[model samples]
Target: MASGQVKSAAFVLLLLNLLLYFIVTVMAVWAVNHAIVRSRKTASVLTIPARIFPIYFPVGNMATGFLVIFSLIAGIVGMATSATGYLNVTDGKIQNLHAAAASSLVTLFLTFLAMGLACKEINIGWIDANLRTLEVLVIFVSATQLFCAGAIHARVSEVATILNIYGSGRV
Candidate 1:
């Protein structure tokens, strides 16, 4: 019920969220490798939906991986700053918490969007090739969205802090 307790709870949740994010990322990478191996053996592309896209193009894997790493870093930084601010309960820290949380959330959102677009592209390629890439891409996109949702949930407390600061008639 106390603010300290709330902050402690938030910290625990954030750590758990981070753990899940890491797990999902690892799984996605594994899935991509598996799909590539299967495709190389069978020379087939897997199709899912017209909305989904294949990521067979050059540099696509690097781009997706970069987005994932960036999102992960942002999430970690945001959660760390938020936990510190909550634990310290000092003035002016709230703004830092807010900005960090917002930036992290935005990064996560962008990452999710990129994953989705990649999935869409992969799905399109599936129509022509029998590659299992579409399934892997879909799983990766789902994981990204789930991770982003967790980050957004973690940001809620920080966002409230920002709103309260502005509402209190203090700059």
Candidate 2:
């Protein structure tokens, strides 16, 4: 595709990712808070399960803790990545573009990690509706993040080619 088209696509994807990441972050925070609250003894009888170190979600299986933590990290990183990508795309600067691309790559990896944990949680069975929503969102975010990163990389190559900037550093 042409440079303009690639840039536009990247911008749109970044915007979408930014919004989704915000939602994911909010959900993660809620989940963590809920887990902590639920783990605490509310009554004299103490009916809840034993509280484990770090965190022990009462809703899902063992993978729930890991999934929530990873999702939170990925959400934060994804937000920053999307913002950097949007700036770079708008400014059309090679250095900013490189930064954006690198951040996007990092976000993609984190998203994938969260996605794997989500899948494991799903497989384990016992997740709540909130977790299921997060799982779906993380999966979707991974796909969009992949496309956004690819578009940025493609734009970098296109710019380098047009400017005759070679890896030899002679340009």
Candidate 3:
């Protein structure tokens, strides 16, 4: 694709990822807080099994804890990736593109981890509506993030090819 087209695609993907990641972050935060408060409120009446769990989630299965934690980390990293991506795309600098690609790759990996946990949680069942929402969002984000990372990586390759062809940005 043309450089302009690549940049535009990257920009749009970054913006979309930013918005989705923000929502994920908000929902994950709420889920964590809700779980904590509920767990604390029921601490006095907890059963032996509940006590054994590191973090008790009232709704989902054991995978809930890992899923939520990974989701929160992915959300945060995804947001930061979006910011760096935006800057790199706008600046059109090869150096910044490298940074953006690295961050996006990290975010992609995190999203994949969260997605895997989410799938496990789903398979185990007993998840609530909010958790289902989070799962869906994480799944969706993982797909979009893959695309975003690919776009950045494509741009990086394009720049590299251009630099190799001409030995510099200037002809």
Candidate 4:
């Protein structure tokens, strides 16, 4: 495929990723609103593991959302530079790909942790059915978005490296 088409594909994927993260963030906020904040204090010592680490789920979800936003922004900036013919294998533009990949990796880790915590909570019946469903959706979508971000980063990096080889590092 031509370089222009590749950048456009990345642009579309980035937009889809942005929308997915936005949805996940909204769902997470809704779940947080419904979840109990302090009622776990009076629970018996027999409480499940979910009771022991309730904050991680919500906080992780929020952090994933934030990281995804950064990745999305970085993706857009990278695309803009590529479109303007400013991309280089050994220049500041390469940093954008690295930043996006790093953000996505962190987001993926946090979302996975959140999903595990959500499962614990679900098993113990600590979460409402409706909110549990939404939270699960958020976790799942965020995971997919993070995966795409990683893929885009890899594609851009490979392309940049190949272009460098062809250009003999002169550009």
TM-score of each: 0.43, 0.89, 0.94, 0.54
Residues 150-170, model 1: lDDT tens digits: 543445565466568776422
Deviation in Å, model 2, residue 158 alpha carbon: 0.7
- lDDT per residue, candidate 3, 1-171, as tens digits? 998888889999999999999999999999899888787666557787777778677667889988988899999989988987898878877888899999999899999999999999999998889999999999999999999999999999998899998787621
**Residue-by-residue lDDT tens digits, candidate 4, 49-160:** 6456534333333233333333333334333333322222133355555655555555555556555555555555544455556456645655665545555566566667
> How accurate locally, in lDDT, is each candidate?
0.45, 0.85, 0.90, 0.49
Arrange candidates by lDDT, descending: 3, 2, 4, 1
Find the candidate with the highest lDDT and give its number: 3
Question: Between the candidate structures 3 and 4, which one is better when assessed by TM-score?
Answer: 3
Worst 10 residues of 1 by lDDT: 126-135
Ranking by TM-score: 3, 2, 4, 1
Q: What residue pairs are clashing in model 2?
A: none
TM-score (C-alpha) between model 3 and the true structure: 0.94
Which residue runs of candidate 2 sit more than 4 Å off their true CA positions?
42-50, 165-171
Candidate with top TM-score is 3
Candidate 1: segments with Cα more than 4 A from true spot: 44-92, 107-171
